[model samples]
Each structure stands twice: as structure tokens, then as C-alpha cells.
Target: RRLKKKHFVIECDPLVHEGFESTARHVEIPYLPMLVPPTKWKGYDKGGHLFLPSYVMRTHGVKDQKEAIKSVPRKQLRKVFEALDILGGTKWRVNRRVHDVVETIWSRGGGIAGLVDKGNIPLPEQPETEDPDEIQKWKWSVKKTKKANRELHAERCDTELKLSVARKMREEDGFYYPHNLDFRGRAYPMHPHLSHLGSDLCRGVLEYAEGRPLGKSGLRWLKIHLANKYGGGIEKLSHESKLTFVEDHLPDIFDSAANPVDGNCWWINAEDPFQCLAACMDLSNALESSSPHGAVSHLPIHQDGSCNGLQHYAALGRDYMGAAAVNLVPGEKPADIYSEIAARVLDVVREDSMKDPATDPSVPLAKVLVDEVSLLPAPLCLNQEIFFFMYLFFNKTVEDLDIGSLQVDRKLVKQTVMTSVYGVTFIGARQQIMKRLQEKGHITDDKLLYDVSCYATRVTLDALGQMFQSARAIMAWLGDCAKMIASKNQPVRWTSPVGLPVVQPYKKYKNYMIRTSLQCLALRREGDAIATQRQKAAFPPNFVHSLDSSHMMMTAITCKEAGLHFAGVHDSFWVHACDVDKMNQILREQFVELYSMPILENLLEEFQTLFPTVEFPPCPAQGNFDVREVLTSTYFFN
Candidate 1:
């Protein structure tokens, strides 16, 4: 009955049997055992049962799934392989595929219901002495939340669109087929994700951008410029030219013979014993010596569609790019860092646009957007940051990360800085029909003024008759996100862009509920606490991730082209202090290019095709969101 050897952590729940207590020990099971315990297995202390370590594949020298499984959990290995065969082929990494298999199994009655039905666990009895009215209210909330989740899932998924893209990508590149677990068109981080593979305009424009950094230009200017460049930048390029310019161009750039090498590559190669000793040794070597750039072997810049809360906008541009990484050389600022980083970012974007990943961009894009945005808690943003602080705390450095002349606030490092975009939160709340925004998030110290640019911005309950304006812009934004999450949870099922199906097993919203009495007493519990929180926080975080990914990607490429050392932690881009100025300049220009295109309109167009039957609202006018307004401060990158 155990379909997977590596089943859910049953010991975590107290609902199981507590008889036959025994001393902690490790034993070899006979049956060509389905699950393999990790290398330093600590036997779980349950009456007499053993809870093996959580599944993990060794990071070193794992060339294939077979090699990977030798170290990772063996239970369900066959199931994972079967699923992968159906999904595609060995185009995915072992770790990621393992994760997918576990999730797939869990999603398909492998968790809550499986435990109760197969494990013979008894559900907690309903409280007999509780007040009836409170129970009914809890029941109603749970019902509504379940409904919302299902609807949101449907809005996010579009399997047909995804499967088509995957097929095409496989035909184009055998080794890499973009697949986000949920099948959103956004390419899995492991591969490239361009616009629809068949569209020349989309691919052509993308190539031009990737190959070079051109300042902001209208479509007309772009066409003319590309035309002047021997028509290589457009769909009209000779088949040979397409091969030479885009596909071949990027690989050439990453090679040592073609491009300059700057600082050493600095990456965490060791585990933190406090940090891993082995990784530290490798990082030490890279920091002291030079490494490759511009290719898959180095800091390969890439671009794809994004879901920066403004999916409508990322769709407009249709690509997110990250450049190469360089190590920080003490006081060694490479000259022209700005131009270098810009050139690298542009090249990567253009190249990736021509590459194309999954056909569907919804889920991959949403995942990227949703994953990062979920990292930000309004409380942390309005106060100080947590992630970057943890970094600084670990490194013991007090100097703020600087880009050219701008210094990033440590608090904003992990969380994207919310500038004028705070206004967007209110606009969204209104659109979603959020009625009492003022009553939502709390104000810090009862003062309605928020800190901004060495001055206080006078935020009120309702600015210009807006319902979502408040003391802290982050808090206001989160209030709306919470509403949106609740709304998304109200459905039974939804599909992702890549054809991954997500069906809710619960009949009510108990899984979406927090650590409240109802959840503690229910037959089911929200397995993924973080995902539940993201549903509550909503779009702002998604937007933040897209924006951050794009920004970092651009910086990575810029540094690669300029031949400067480039590495970063989330929002903080790291390079030799000397290259900071050029980093700023190149990023500014790239920012313009990123926004210059008609993104909002394009997103609407994408939506039209992705969800052909649904009618969407008119695209927001260009004036509605001015990049000039967003780029006014470097805080977003900080």
C-alpha cells in the first residue's frame, strides 16, 4: 500500500500510535528497500518507529538521476521516473525532478487522506462543548477560502498552451526543455524562456536586445535600427544569420578567447558548518583566480517573461535577464562598470528571447513572481529587513552595499523597495473591490507619515479618495494581497502553464487557515505554511520577485560584458567598488529598455491567447505606470 517509500513525515503528527517504545537506532531493511536513509541518519525517537531523514540528493558529481538516486530517497524513484517520462524526458535535474515527484505524490492524496486512510490514524473529535455560532462562522470562512483557491488555480493554469510549448522546445533543444512544476510559460530557472517559439517579431526583437544594449526606443526606431543592422535584428533575417547572430553569438561571448575576464567568480561552494568548509575552499579559489563568463559554464545571462505583480507589464517586455557573477576585489573598481553590465544584460536578454523555453508563460512566470514576493512581510519592510541582515550578520560587515553613488538600505535588500508603485496597491484593491482598506493593516506609532528620501510622505486613510492609502505603503499593499489570496482559494482546482494540474482535495478552507483552533481541530492541516501565507499576501510579492529577477539578471550580464567581477545577494549587486559607477549607468539605461516597450498592452495580448475564451479588461494606458516614476530611486534594486 506504500506507493512511495519516502512518504510524508508521519512522526511530525501526534495522531499516530505511541506503543512499543525503543532506543534510537539504524538498521538495514531487506526488500531492496524503497527509501534510503541519508548519510548521518539520526533515528527518530517514537515508541519504536524510525523516522528517516528528509530526502536530499548529494550536490557533487551527480551526472544523472541514477547517480542522484544513489544518495537520495529511493522510495517513489520509479514513480518519479514514470512521471518525468510522461512530462517529457531526462531534461530536468535529479533534485528538481525528485521534488516534483514528491509534490505530485503528495498532491494526489498522498498526504492527509492517505495518512488517515492507510496509516490508520484517527481524526481529532469535534469539540462538543464549543459554541455553535463560532463553529458555523469558522465553517463558512473555510468554505469560502476553499472556493477561492480553486478559482485562482484555474486562472493560473493552462495545460494545453504549456504542452505545445514544451513539445516545440524539445524539438529545438533536446537537452533543455523548460518545465516549471506548475507549467506556467515562464521557463524553469534551469532553462531559457523566450516568447512563443514560433513568433518572429517576438524572437527577432528579443535577439537584438540580447546582443546589445540600446537606449529606450519606440517600435519604429527599433525596426529601423534593426533594419540598418543588415536586417539581422528582425524576423526577416536569413536563416543562416539567425543561427550566426543569436544561437552562436551567446556561446561565443562566454568563451575566454572572445571576451575579457574580470574578477574571480565567487559562489558558495561549501556548506555552512557555520558555512561549509569544502564550499569555502572552492569559493576562496574562485575569489583569488579567474573563471569563465558569458556561457552556461559561467554566469550565463538569460531573459524570460515575468510576473512582477504586474504580469500585465512583464508580459509586455516578455523576458527577464540575469548577468554573470564577479567577485569583489578590495578597492579594485573596474572602469566603465555601467556600460559593461548593461551590455551583458542586453546580450543575454536578446539571446534568450531567441532561444524560447516553455510555450506557456503563466505558471513559470507566476511562480517566479509569487515565490519572491512572498518573501517580503510588510512588517519587515516597514521596519528593517531580515534576510540581508542575516547575511551581514553572518559576514559581520556593516558597510551598506553601494551601486555607483547609491547605497542600498539593508532593510530593503531582500524586499524590493516600494516607491511610487505603492499607489498601484490601492488601484488593485479598488479593482478587486476591497472595501475597507483603511481598516486593514496597522500604522507604525500611530503616525500617518512614512519615511522616504530623508523626508516623510504624508500618507492618510484615503489619499485622493483612494481606499488603500495608508501610513506604510507595504502594509497597504499587503492588505489587498490578503484579500486576493482569500479570493484565489475559493475554487476546487486550477492548471499551471506547463500542463501541471493542481486539484484541491479538501472540501473546505481548513488547509488555508492559519494556526487557529479550527485548523488544529480539523481532519486536515495546511501542509505548506509558506504557500498558505503567500495566498494571503497576494500580488505585490510576485511583482517584487519578477522585478528583482530582471534587475539582478541585468546586472549579471552588464558585469560580464564590462569584464568586471559581478555577484549579488538578492537585491544587492556585488562587484569591485571601482565598477560601481558604470554598474549604475548601465542599469539605468537597461531599465529604460526594459520598460520602453508597450508591456501592459502586450501582457493583455498574451492573456488573450493563453485564455482564449476569457475577455480581459483593456490594457492600462502607458501613462498609468511611468518607468520614470519607478526609476526615480534605486531602492527597488536595493
Candidate 2:
């Protein structure tokens, strides 16, 4: 038995066989092979532990920045370091634009290094740093990089804030500075962007500013013109200096002042476009001695510069014309407000909310002004229940109950809503309102903080961090969705519905799909990474937006059929004030035509083809469509 046990427990031995190739006597030879080994994956170091592969970093949002920086060839790396030596380490105020890109990238660590390392682009030459101060400057440069980055973000916020305040002051208090006005005597040197970017859409009656208390409530010091008398973009002034305008007794003068005509000759002002148009009607009425067709209507749509317009790009229709987008939202804040309002006005009774909100009568009254004097049309008033937004769009809480459909929930409506239903222009002001509401200790909830947190997302957080950094768990869940969808394919590339190819950030480095990042699928936490996959989930909405742009572009082309000179910023259009009625008519018609197309179905069909085997979640609320529901709301575009 012992012998048998020993035999069974025998030691394992390797079976090795060696074969020798017969030497060929006279071989027509191939070239001699070099001593290079086979290619292997280049992995990058991340936060400690095992290094992450560049594929994982690119395919996921987790940037292996250290490895990325190291991946740069030594020659290029030295150039970037040299550029930083010139810029005081990280000061954005640079004398030469040549070194800006490289110095900026170097300061931030990695991102653009691959661009230079590949010899795709050479770093612009800047004056060499030879000063004794250069040594100490660069030593602290990397240390101060984080702070400098923060300052850059702060500077962006300041720009937005200044633009907001300038829009308000321009509307509320016209600076007599002659330089501010452009060739047509309109506000010149405006930011390339539009006004009230963070506010809700300015949907209101165009006829009356009579009883409208007409301005943001607490911009206390904007009653006077700029003290310098050199009217330029608000960026020209310091933050402290910009806020010190005289606020007592100036709104009337500002209103009475000549409104500037923009490039399109549209009347730019603080009032909603609808309100301005009505005001133009009154002005035309006053100017015309003769009645046309005896309609008893007169208002000259001439130049006036008091109003501030939005650069909005909302698409609601179906086909080329987007006819089905019965409800349209232009800017971000406006979209949020109108989305809430739509939830209310379109609300319907439900057994566990089974009824479609679109069935309610309040829908028509939702965005339309009750009368000319009203400031807001009818934005949904928040109560303790709906006090906070669930997210930027389509997020909802259980407290957002069915009473909104009843239209009789005035008791549920809070007093924060003013009698005049004007749109919110400054998101900061809007946040202040929310904070004030929270302080009252009535409806305060975590959603308010979450909503506040989302503001950072709007300002553009780090490309990789955006997914994991969502304030709400749902956003993270959505990030997971993005991951799943994006993981199915490598060398992933998709074009917008209108043809703008979705460029990968990896392209920013190598200018090509390196396939280096797709190996992320092999990672242990393959399910968790989403930074790179955000575009996947965003595809549907982004495609719709592209269609919106397409529809608008075609609409601009089509509008020529009616002798109109039209210019649009996405969903919103600007024309001479006199053309307001005509523009609205054409816009409504064009929207109807666009919606008439089967845009949503087409998009879904494309989605199904791309994600054939993979089971995706049910269609999101943003993409769910009902042309019947849309056809009834003329105020949708407004």
C-alpha cells in the first residue's frame, strides 16, 4: 500500500521536446530580423496600486494623467516644460499666444501632451526664460497648478456673472457712454454669446411693460450708467466697479432710451421678445397716421436696444421642419422652468399617475401671458413638494404629485411667485430664490443642494470627472448606462443627425482612433467607468438637438419664401421688431412643418440598429413623443 501511494503521489516532470530545422543549402533570403520584441500595451499610472491602461483611461473617464504625461517623448516634454518656465508657472495672463496651448496643457499636467509628442503639431516658440526668477517660479508652478485651475474656473463664473449683470443694467439703466452703441446705435461689443443664458425662456406677452415691475428685485446698485463713460463689454470693468451703479430712479430712463438694432436689426431689450413685439405694436400704432386695411393696428418695428436676447437652440419638431415640437424651450434655465410648467399645465388625473399630463386644459395657458401687463406667463409655482428640480431635465420626485393637473392647487403654490409672471434671467438670482425658500424651513430638502451642485456640471467640469461627479445618484446610474452603451464598440465614432462627427477626446492627443483606450473592457471594474461613455447616452438628445439645428437652418432657408430676412440662435430667432408678428407666424408654421416629420422614429430606428442585441432601457422621457399633444400648443415655440 505504501508503494502504491508513492506511485500515485509521483512528482510531476516536464515533457520537453526540441526540434531542429534542417539548414537550407541555398536560401533566397528575406531581410534580417531586428532584435525588437513584439508590441505590448502601454499602461498608465493613476492613483496608486496597479497602473491603469491608456485604453481604460480613454474608454473610461478615469484619466491616467501621469502616464499620459510620461508618454510624451522627451524632446516634446522638454518643450512643454520650457514653455511653462515662461508663463510664471501657471499665470494665464501670457504675453505670447504662441506658448499658450502648450503652457496651458503643461500647467494642467497631461491632456495635450500626446498632441505634441506625436509630432502632429509643434509647440510654438516663445522667448526663452533666462531670468534668475525662472527657477523659483517653476519650482512652485506645479504646486500652484490646482489653485490656478480653480482661479480659471472662478474667472469663467465671473464672466458669466458680469454678462448677467450687464444685461440687467443695460435693460434697467442705460449708460450714456456713446462707445457702447454699435453702428446702428444698438448695444455693441456684446459677448459673442447671448443674454440671460442661465435663465428660463423669456416667454411673455409682447404688448405691455405698463404695470410690470420690470427688473430683477435686488440688483441694488445698477441705477446709474458706467462711471467711466467708455461703454464696452462688462468684461472691461472689474467685478467691484461693475456692481456699483446707481440704482435709484433709472429704470424709466433706461426703458425710454433708444433700443439698439443688432446685426439682424432686431430690437434688443430686457423685456421678453413677445413683450417687445407688442410694445412695437404700440409704437407702430403711435407712428402710423394712416390705417392699413382698417385693422386699427399700428406699431413700427424699428430699432430699440433695451432688450437682451438669448442664444437658444431648441428643436421640437419631427422632420426637417420639426413640426411636432409643439413645446420648445430655448435656453437652459428657460428649458428647466418651462419643463416644470409643462408638467403642471399638461397634468391630468391619474391612478398612480396613469393619465398623461398633456390632456389638461391648462396646457394652453401655461406659457402664454394671462394679459399684457403680467411679467411671467404661468411658470409652475413651487410648493413644498416641487420646491427643487430633480435634475436639469426630466428628473422628478414623488412629491411632484398630480394636483398640478387640477389647476386649482393655488394652495400648493408658494408666494415666491410674483403676480407678474416673468421669466428668470439670472440663474444665480434663481438660486438665491431657492436658498431663500429653503431658509423659510418649509419645503427645504436635499434636492435644493443637488440642484445647486448641477450648476457646476453646466459650467463644464473636467471631461473625465463629469460622470462620477453628478450630484444625484441617478446621474451616476445614467453614467453606467453610458458605459454599457459605449462598451459594445471600440473605435467608436458617431455623427450627429446633421453630420457633425462626434470627435473623441483621444483625438485631441493622437488625432486618430488609436484603439489604445478600448482595452478598458479587460479591466476588473469594467462596469464602473463612464467618463468616456457619456457621449453614448447623450447621443439621443444630442441627435435631436442636431435635428433642431437642421430644422432651424432649413427654416431660415425656407423663410426666404416669405420675403423675410431671418437669423436664428437655435430655436429663437431675431428679426426687425416690425417683423415680430410675421416672424412668429412663420416660426409657428415652420415648427409645424418640422414636427410633421418623423424625426423621433427615425432616431429610434438608428438606435435599434446600433444596439441590436443589447437590451437598452425603455425610451427616456426626453425622447418619448406625441405629435397630437404638440399640435395644440402654439406657445410651445415661444
Candidate 3:
């Protein structure tokens, strides 16, 4: 009867039938979906072992019963696989107090409200008019409002899902999230709803099941971690300064932990509110203990990279200035790359504003010229009208310009600067800046907001080009190489430092209509022709990403070997407070080791070998800065 019911549902649901058909095409023999009857819930086995289902553990007709290790790529990949195994096996449990707050927020559909007040509800006033222009304007506003609401709804749903999973798993002794790598070899948790790889709320609700005693050093590091979560200038402080900042904020932190929703709600203002609250709670617990230094802690302390992609580029090119700007070399405090970029952009804008209209050829002038004798007393002449218009255009006074009104800060241009390495187009930068402006809710007029965003994007890109000259040249070289290879109708391919094979899968796809019982679905199938433009545009960033992943994997492997638990979110790495210093040393060593190899030269050689007839350009010239300097750089990863 159950089988009959399952079959009935499969037949009746067009989406399910389509999914089954798709699955069947990939496998040699398609089997019916597994059926689990409703029964008393039994979480995990008696010994606290949570085994992955047989279906999830199988690949290529081989079932992994013991370790659930899938097909290993190569020898180097084995180390990465081992690292992933170590990461996945790390146990975690819910912080019930934080979980309760998150659940409450989720129930209210206000998960995103903490990040952006009233962001979910965008209600534009409807115009009561029959005029076509007004109606069109109203329609556009409605469309934008709907888009905002949809995004909010999606976020709400995501919060609901995460909270539900956390609630169910809270009762267990602990649970583990399995890990997998993307095609670029970047590892991510396989569990969708709950893991360390989640937002601030998700992360806050979780704590390592295995606790370590917070010794003096560990306690100090934990204080530093708390300061880091508060962000702003606190994150740029030296270790001791950060600790001091945390100490200064002890009253606020304790209050936040004691009465999170009621008291001062100081944690709500933090960069990561929920996580900050969690850190506050941890700090409060440690301090309240009879032996503060001996208190057990399960919170993971993170040491994040500063503009990591640019850091890699700087290291690759040996650009000392770029390296220093990104905190690659030793420094008292962590570098603020975003603020530096913002300052550069402001300088450019100010310089542009101060340009002489009469001498500068770029400045627009009034086309009409009027004699002083022809000045009319009753009304202005055509020349006067033109001159008046050009006066506003060419000569914007400091007060009229209101450069400060734009509030060109680190936050405004951070996203643009970050993605500039990945070949963000001018239009893309404008959109990114526009989104930031919209979120800030400063410029109410859409037209003026868009103009400001466009202006900001130009200056941001200009600043980046000036600041990271070597990175720009390298990006150009990579793009050129990709174009040369892709013009011959072949996808660009490369090997990462960790020997993970990477192939740019960008290609033209042919769309075909598949008629189903309920609807006609348009499906895309890979075509023989290569997508040359996409291949060229994506290669530089993709190649950089592969290298980034390589560095991460190397660090992960060494951390495991050194008996340290590790969790990585791309450039951001996390470990136990006691093990942070060890993990940092390991990461720095791995980064230096990874870059020490002739990476670009090897890539050129590989390209030559793969396409013998095609002549690739020489690798970008390197600077004089030593890669070993990273070893001594304290803020290289912090």
C-alpha cells in the first residue's frame, strides 16, 4: 500500500517525475526512492555515532561503510580528503540560549531585520493618476518593492529552515556536518541548513562539543576574538589593544549576555550581532567562574585574511606596497584596505571637482557666446541661458557638490573593491554601489542615487587600479592567456598548487524543449562550441580561486597533522582559542610554501603542452619582495 501511494505521488507530480528522469539519465540503473515508515524517533546509535545513509556513502558502485570516503582524486588530493575528513568529524552542538533567541526572531520573520531595519517590507506609495508617465513610474516602483519583498521572504524561509534543524539537533550529544569540495576544490559543508558555514545567527547557535580549558593565553585570545566581532576600528587594533577594548566593554558585554533582549541590547549594534552575543556569553561565563583561566570554552576563534584575493595577487607579484597594504608584512596593527581604498577614491573625487573649467579640455563649455552690449534687461538671451546651464555643469561648488553627502566610506566601496579582482565590469560596479546606497537609505531620488553610484564606481575602480598596479597587470596577463586559449574553441585548464585538476567548464549550451505531462520544460545541454568571452572573463578569478583553495587545503592538512581542529570559510580560518597561534603559524607557512613554487611559469608550460601550436605570452614579471616575509607577518591572516 505504501509502495502504491509512493508511485501514485511520483506519477501525479510533474516536478518529481522530471527530477527522477534527470537522475535516471546520470545513472546506469535507476532505483526507486527509499521509503522510511513513520515510527518513534531514534536520533543516533547508542555510542553517539551518526552514520551517513548507504546511498549518501556510495559512488561508482562502491559503498564506503567505515569512513565514507569517496573516490580520491590523487595523492595530493588524499591529504585534502584527509583534511576534509578531520573537519567533518569535528563535533558541534547548539548553544540553547542563543538558539532560543534565534528561534524567536525566526518566528517573527525578523531574522533579516537585525541586519537591515524594515528591509523586508518595502511599500512604495501608489500614484492615483491616469497619466501614462506617472503610471509607468508607479509600475517601476511596484516592481522594485516586489523584488525587495521577495528577497526578504526568501531570507525568512532560510532562517525558518535553519532554526528548525537546530531545534531538532539540539537534544543530541553532538552532531557533525559532512564536507565536500566544489569543482574549484573549495571545501564546504554538505549539510545545507546548519553548519559553521552559516550566517552570524547560525554560527552563534553552534559551539564545539569538545571543550578545551581556556588557559591564560586562551583567555586573552578569546577577548581578542570578542573585539574582532565588534568590528570597526576594534578589529584593526593590535592583540593587546583588542584585549584592552574587550576589557573596556566588559560592562556592556556582560549586560548583553545577561539580558540580551531586554537590557541595553549592546550586542545588536555589533558587526555580527548574534555571534557577538555568543562571544559575550562566553566571556561572561569565563569571568564569573571561580577560576577564570581554567574555564572550559568551545567557541571557535577566527583569524581572517585581509582582502585575501588581493593578498594572493600581491604575494604572487611580490608587490611590497600592495603586500603591506593588505597586512602581508609585519605590522603593529592590521591594515585597513577598505579605508585606504575609500580615501583614495575621495582624493580622486576632490581632484576631479577642483579641475579648472577654463583650462581643462575635458570640461564642458557653453556653445553660445554673447557680447556685453547685447545684454537684455527684460529677459535673458539664448547665450545667457546656455551659459547659466553650463555654469552648473562645469562649476559645481564644494557646497553644491556635497561630496560628504555621498558618505564615501569603506562600506560603500568594499564590495566593488573586493570584486574588482574578479573582473567586475563598470555596470556591475555601479549596480553593487547602487545596492549599497539603497541599503543606506540616504539618497531617496532613484535618478540621483544611480548617478552617485555611477560616480562612486568609477572612482573606486580608478583607486584600485592605482593602488594595485601589479595585480592589474597580472589580471590582464591572465585574461590575455585565457583569450588566446579560448579563441581556439578550447576551455582553459590549469592545476592548482595542491595538484587539484581544474578545468574551466564554460561552454555554449543548446536549449531544447522537453514536453512533460503538465508542462514543456526548456532544458539546456552542453554544446561543442566553447563560450570564448565567458572563458576569458572567468579564467583569472577562477584561477585565483583555485590557488586560494589550494592554500586553504594546505593549511587544513597541516592543522590536522599538528593535532588542531580546523574550520575554514574560504579566506577566514577558525580554530580553538588555545590552538589559534599554532593554526596561524601553519597557515602562514603553507601560504609561503604554496607561493614559493614557480606557479605562473608552470601554468605557462602546461598551456604550451596542452596546446602545442598556440603560443602563450611570457609570465608576468615578479617584484623584488621576498615571499618568506609572510612568515614574520603577524597580521598576514588576522
Q: Give the number of the best model, judged by TM-score.
A: 3
lDDT of 1 by residue, 1-638 (tens): 66763423334232221121110011122211111111221111111112432222222221322232343333423322222222222121112221232233333533221111112223234456589987776676667665664443332222222222333333222232212221111212112232322222112211111112222222122222222222111222222332333222232222311111221211111111101111122122232344311111111111211112322222232212111101111112211222223223222323333443586322232222122222334234221123234333443211122121111121211112122233334333332212221222222222221211111111111221231122134334333433433344431122222222222222222333245643332354433222444443433344444444454445555556776544333344433323444555565555655566553454446545545555545532222334443233322221
lDDT of 2 by residue, 1-638 (tens): 45642222443231210010111112222211111211222222221112222121222342333334345454433322221121111101111111232233333432231211111122233337877687566655554664554454343333333333333333321111100111111111112222211221111111111111212211111111121111212211232333332122123223322232212212222223323323333333333435322222222122111111111111222111121221342221112222232233223211213433488433233222111221212343332213232211233321232224322222222221211011222353345434543553433356644453233222212211221121122223333444555676431233333322332222122122333532212223323233354444443333334444544545444555565444444445544333444555565555556556544445445555667775645432333334343234423443
Candidate 3 versus the native: TM-score?
0.80
Better of 1 and 2 by lDDT: 2
Positional deviation of 457 in candidate 2, in angstroms? 17
Note the Cα lDDT for every prediction shown: 0.28, 0.30, 0.71
Kindly report which residue stretches of model 2 are placed more than 4 angstroms away from their true locations once superposed: 1-484, 489-500, 503-533, 604-632
Please give the distance, in angstroms, between residue 315's alpha carbon in candidate 1 and its true position after superposition: 14
List ranges where model 3 is wrong by over 4 Å: 1-73, 108-136, 357-406, 514-521
For residues 410-442, what per-residue lDDT tens digits would candidate 3 score against the true structure? 577888888988879999999998888788675
Cα RMSDs, all models? 22.9, 24.9, 12.1
**Using lDDT as the measure, which candidate wins?**
3
